[model samples]
Target: MKAKVVALLCFLNLCWLLIGGGVFSALEWQHESAERVSFEDTRSRLLQNYSCLTEEEVTNFIRAIVTATNAGLTLDNSTASDTSNWDFGNSVFFSSTVISTIGYGHISPSTYGGQAFLVPYALIGIPLCGLMLNGIGENIGNFITKKKEQYKKRWSKKVSDRTAEVLVMLILFLLFLVFLVLIPSAIFLALEGWSYHISIYYSFVTLTTIGFGDYVPGQNSAQRVVYRLAILCWFMIGLSWMAVILNQVSTFLTDIGVKAQTAREERKKKKEGDVGEEGEENKAAEDEENWGSTKSAKQSNVELRNMTPIES
Candidate 1:
């Protein structure tokens, strides 16, 4: 039954991912197509303006720019020469995100040695990070459970046990949203000059480890180190909170499946028991009828013998 439940969950998750893919494609395809056409038009205009530049040279130049861009190079003439990605702050951010499984695509290792090291680095670090997150989540869950128990004890008459549990969870969820998600989002909106909605979106994407790379903070080199530390702390707590929520949801689903399976088994056993009892009653009635018929036949035989003796 557990296997079946797990398989069903996997299938549903796959279907959900497929649906997301289709919807995103439908939403973004036209914009992507337009961008491609615009890029091609720009290339043509550039070639027309520069008669000396051959197509091969243009292609090579464009490839070089793209390569640099993907490798986290800043091309701005003002600070480009002074800026370095391998600095202490950026490296700390990179390593933390990598281990936490966020892997925001803002910057990445460009060298062969760095890339090879990344494989083992992440492989070992992800599990260790998971262990930390799990530990934090478990502690949070236990705290919530203890609080729920206390609530239930106090409101034992007014609210049911289930109702108390649900209320506690709801309150915790609201607190998390206000403190962890919405509040931080407001700060991001103010600091990053993004709209409130976009900041909220970024908060969720970062916490969920979906790191789309489209909306990263700290794009400005002038941003302070305090902001970086705050964001890192937020990521740790938010990820742990998310883990707790997911664990509870999974446990709830599994419990539902197990209860349904148990009820079905119980009903089947009851049905078999009823059938067995009915069969036993019918067999007892049949045996009683057979014994009565045999007794009557013996009585008739005795009377016949008495009548024959009188005739003699």
Candidate 2:
């Protein structure tokens, strides 16, 4: 029954995935079609206004502009020696995002070499990041489990095992929330001159790996290197903290499921045992009644046999 329930859940999840994918694909197609139409209209207007350029030339020019923009290059800004996107701090930030799979994409590799390096870089870095996060999470989880055990032993009358676990999880969660989310948000607010709410939103978005690309930090700052490094550290620690929380939550849920399943099995066994006992009792009662009837019939026969004279 449990296996069937799990299979059904998996089937439902697959269906949900397919439906979501189809809806998103349709929306993307519509958006791309509209964008293409708008692009063609703009191109025609530009060609009409500037008759010197042919359609093909305008197309090539637009492609060049797009490619340069995506590559983080600025063709118009000849006087600017260095683009902020390619600076040390921003580069580090971009690299961290790539490895972490956050990919906020505010700044990206502009060169073919850089792009080529990024693929292998991420292939190596992502696994390393995963290993680091997992290791940290496991250690923290073990620590909490140990602490809970110690508490159970020390305060046998006061604290239960489940209560100790809950307390540990809550404390860890609060610590992470304050240090990784709240404090960072406050710092970002001061550094980026953003509102407190926006800072908090950005922190949550980045840590959660959503990377919506709506709000980015250190884009226009003079202290680019320091800010980017700080952000990178925040990403690392925040990701690890998130992993810890997830680990605890998963453990808690799994424990609950196991206990519930055990309880259910016990109940089922008890019910079957009750039914078996009741059947045995009924059988025993029937056997006793039959024995008593057979003995009474034999005794009547014996008594008749003893009354020989009156048997006529």
Candidate 3:
């Protein structure tokens, strides 16, 4: 039941990240819009008496052409067409475009409604997403730990120096990284007709979680979520691969053998040291667990104060 609850919460958090990130991401990406335009109401007034063309007349003529074509699109809905500053819909779009790093530069918590919605939304959303990702990442880390042990065991019987095996694996990883990730990304950019630099930037930004929102996939709303999900896959794989690399580095540092007690002790010490550093916080959180049924509340408090911090 607990696992189900946790998983459901995680799934909901992931969905919220997807939706919010999609909208917010779209807004920041607005700055990189491909086209710019200037809309003026004077085009109609100028065109009423003027029919001849001069060197400077070309500017007025072009405005007349645009004015005739747009008719009411610009006049009736001026704010909608206005590109002077970032707009609300654009801001919402900016958030949902990336995983995190939502940039609502144009529409912060300024208005009464904006303040009412944004503050609690952000406070809950950020931690929920963080918790969800970390919970999922723990599973990936466990998988990596197992894979590392398997590799060590496989190499232990025949290989004299584990260094050579690690090097070989690193080489294989590099090859896979290039072929599986980089090449496909290149092909995607080429096929999509996006700039090579922007594509690469998106790929790296997505995997690293830096998500500057300078670039994103699927310009249109219809398939943007799909693009984000594809990018999420990249993040997951990159993280898993990083864990594999970290395990290799750790293996080199710790002697690879049946009896490497010193390495185990060192790792344990590091874990304990980290817990020691968080001693006060941990004790405060778990204070209720320290008590017995018979103890008075005041006495329990005194005992708890005297107790030393320990790790889970």
Name the top lDDT candidate.
Answer: 1
Best by TM-score: 1
- Candidate 1 per-residue lDDT, tens place, 24-119, comes to 999999999999999999999999999999999999999999988888878899867887777888888889889998888879998899899999
Q: After superposition, how far is residue 256 of candidate 3 from its true place, in Å?
A: 13
Q: By the lDDT metric, which is better: model 1 or model 2?
A: 1
TM-score for each of the candidates: 0.89, 0.74, 0.41
Better of 2 and 3 by TM-score: 2
Instruction: Name model 3 segments beyond 4 Å from true.
Output: 1-99, 102-112, 158-180, 183-187, 232-312
Write down the RMSD of all candidates, one decimal each. 2.4, 4.6, 20.8
**Which pairs clash (backbone N, Cα, C closer than 3 Å) in model 1?**
none
Better of 1 and 3 by lDDT: 1
* Number of clashing residue pairs, candidate 3: 22
Q: Write the per-residue lDDT of candidate 2 for residues 1-312, one digit (tens) a residue.
A: 488879998999999999999999988989999999998899889999999999899879889887766665546565235655766666777888888999987667757998899989999999998898788767877887788677768766777777877877888888988988889889888888999999989988998899987788876677777777778878887888788788788888789889998999999999999999999999999999999999999999889888868574
- C-alpha lDDT of residue 260 in model 2: 92
User: Per-residue lDDT tens digits of candidate 3, residues 181-267?
Assistant: 577579557656677766766566655556554554443334445654564555555644544555556656555542466678999
lDDT of each: 0.86, 0.83, 0.57
